[model samples]
Target: MVELVVQKYGGTSLQTTGRMAEAADRIIKETKRGSQVIVVVSAMGRTTDDLTTLAGQVSSCPPAREMDLLLSTGEQVSCALMAMALKAGGVEAEALTGPQAGIITDFSYGDAVIKEVDPEPVRSRLKEGKVVIVSGFQGCPGGHEVATLGRGGSDTTAAVLAGALKADRCEIFTDVDGVYTADPGTITGARKYEQLDYESLSALAELGASVVHPRAAAAAEAWQIPLVVRSSLTEQTGTTILPGTWSSCSFPVIGVTSETGLSSFSLHEGADRREIGREWKNGLCPWKAVQHVKNRLYRIVVRNEEAPHTKSLLSRFGGRPDTGRALVHVIFRSKEGKQKAGSFMRDLPYTQDCFMVETQPHVWSMDVPERHRVNICQALHDRCMEKEAAPISAAH
Candidate 1:
C-alpha cells in the first residue's frame, strides 16, 4: 500500500513566488516517491497582517463576520497559486477552499472550532492521482458564511485533516528545521532535538515555542498521529514527535520556552476572584492563572493582543493592570529535572522586578522584564540545559 502524508506549509515557507515554486517541487518529488500528498497552506508572507491593517483603516471596529470573510481570502490566494505551481511542475493538482474540501466548523466567526471533516472530497482527488491543496485557515460554519480558525489555525487544519484521513503522518514545514532547546535565533549553541514525545512538544508549544501550535499538537496526540517538524528550504531531517515521553538518563529539563507581549492584572484585597474570573468572557484565555490567592493579591496574565478588551472587562472588578511583561518557562521531563531547575531559579541573580513561581511540577514560570527575557533564557540554557544535552545538535 502507498503511504499517505499531509504536508502543511506555513506563511514563511510560501512567502514568495520562488518559495511557492520550490514548495511545489518538494510536493512533486514526494509524489514521484509513490506517496499520496495533501497540501495545506497559509497566507503568503504578511498578507494576513496587511489585510487586518486594511480592515482597521476602513473601520475602527470592523464586524467580526466581515473581518473573517476578508482574512479567509489570503489562504485561498496561496492555495490556488500552489496548484498553479504544481501544474507548471508537470503534476496534476487541484486547489480547494476549506469548505469545498468539506471542513465543517462551529459558528464562532473569528476563531471557529472544527466540528468534523467529510474526507470524500479530498479522498476522491487523491484517488484520481492528483495532489489536493486545501486552503488552511477558513471553513464554513453553515450556509455561505466563511469562518476562520484564528492564529496558527493552519496548523490545526493540517492536524485535523491528517487525523480524519488517517494519513501515515503530518509534516509541518516551517522556517526552523526542528524543535530546539531554546529559540535558536536568540540563544547561541541551542540544541535541536531529533525526536520528542507528544506531551513534551505540547508543553513547549503552550509555553510559547512557535515551532508548533498547541492545539495542533493536542489534536495530533489525541489521534495518535505522528508529526514531523521540518524546514521547507533544507533537505535535513527534522524533529519527529511520536508517542511516549523521553525515557533518557540525561537531564530531564529538555527545553526552556518564553512568551512576550503580555499584560497582567492584580485584583486587590476583598476582591471577588471567582466572580471576576467567571464574569470575564473575552476571546483571550489567561496565560498564567494564579492557582493560589496569596494575601491581598490575585493576578492573571493575558495576551497583549486582547489586552484592551481584557482591561476593559477587568476594570469593573478593580483589577489593576501592568503591561510590558514576559513569561519564561523551564520545562522538565522528570521530577529530578524540575528540582534542579527550581534550585537554579532560586540562585539566579536578578533584580526585584523578576518573580519566579512553580506553576506546575514539571514547569517553572517567571514574570520578568520583557527586555531581559532573552538574556535570562540564555543564562538558564547555558547553565542548566547544555551540559546534559550533549547528544543533540548545537547548530541552529
Candidate 2:
C-alpha cells in the first residue's frame, strides 16, 4: 500500500454532523484506495467564536491560559464528534487532541507554532488498520500552555502532519470549487486555475488568498510535499498545487482575488524615506490579484514630512494618537488615500471595470494587484520596451 495521505478538512467542511459524515466518507474512501489516511480537522463553523464570546461573558477580559483552555474545547469537540461519526459508519477511527497526538511546541498561548510531532501513536493506530483523526488548529504541547495556530493555522497543521507521516500528498478540502482568480463571492467570472506550483500558490496565499495558509505552504514546500485544494461539495477535479508548473494555457487572465479589511496609508513627510518606509513593511498587505489582462499592480511605500501632521492624519482616520504602539506607524487608508483608490485602479486591470478608467490620471499608489492590473500599464510597459528595441535595432 502507498504511504498514508494526510488530509485536512476546514471548519466549514465540518460544520454539521451531516457534513462530518460526508467528510468521514471521503476519508474512508481515501483509506480504501490503498492510502493510509490521517485526517486533521478544525472546530465546527462558528464554534470558536461562540466559545470566545462565552468566555468573555464570564470575564470581560480572560487570561491567556484560560483563553487557551476555553478555545481548545471547540477542536476537541469536533474531533470527538468526527470520530463518533466514523465509528457509526462501521469504520474504526480514533480521535486525538494536539497534546495526545504528540504535537509539541514552544510555550505560547493562543498562538503557537509546531516544534515537533511524534507520529508514533498515529503510526500505531494505522498499524492496527484504524484511521486517525487529529485535531487541526489547537495543540497542547507543554504544561498549562495550550497553543493554537493563529488564524487559519489548520492548514499549517495539515502540512505538518503530511511532513511527519512522509505522505505523498496533503489534500485540503474546503467549501469552494477550487482556488479562483478572484473570490467567487465577489467576481462571477473569476477563472479557476487547473493547477499551481507551491511557490505561486504560496505567494498568492501570502498576498491575500485565504485558501491556504502561508505557514502551511512553507512547511509543505520545505518538505517537498504536494498539496491539493479540493472541494467537499463534489468529487470533481480540484486545483492541484505542485512544486512547479502544470500544463500550458492561453487564459490571458489567470484569476482575481480581493482583500477586505484593507486599509491604505500615505507617508509624505520626507524625500527618500526608504528607511522609515522599510519599518512599515510588516503591516503591508501582501495579497495580489490579476484584474483582467492588460495591467499589473504593485505595493509601494509612502512616507510623510512631519510626525505631528502624520499623527493628525492618523487620528482623523480612527487611529489612536499614540504613535509608539500603533500597528500602522504611518497613516494609510486615510480619507485622501481612499479617495485616490479610483485614480490608482484606473491604471491597473484591478480597475478595468472602474467608472472612469480612461479619465483618471495614474497616481503611484501602493495598492496594486499583481495580476490583471490596469491593462494600460502593460500597454505602457510594452510600448517603452518596443521603443527601446526600435532605437537599438535601428542603430545596429
Q: Cα RMSD to native, each candidate?
A: 3.1, 10.6
lDDT of 2 by residue, 1-396 (tens): 477788888889999988889999988788678878888888999999999989988998799877877788888888899889888888889999887787887667778888998889788998888889888887766774677877887898889988988988898898886665545554434446666666556645754568888899899888888788878879967777766532232221232223333222332333233432343344442311111112321122122223444345344334322121111100112244334333333454434322221111111222322333333333323322221221111010
Q: What is the TM-score of each candidate against the true structure?
A: 0.92, 0.72
Model 2: lowest-lDDT 10 consecutive positions? 323-332
Q: Candidate 1's residue-wise lDDT over 24-59, tens digit each? A: 999999999999999999999999999999999999
Q: Candidate 2: global Cα-lDDT? A: 0.62
Q: lDDT of all predictions, in order shown?
A: 0.86, 0.62
TM-score of candidate 1 to 2 decimals: 0.92
Say what the RMSD of model 2 is.
10.6
Best by lDDT: 1
Deviation (Å) of 284 in candidate 1: 10
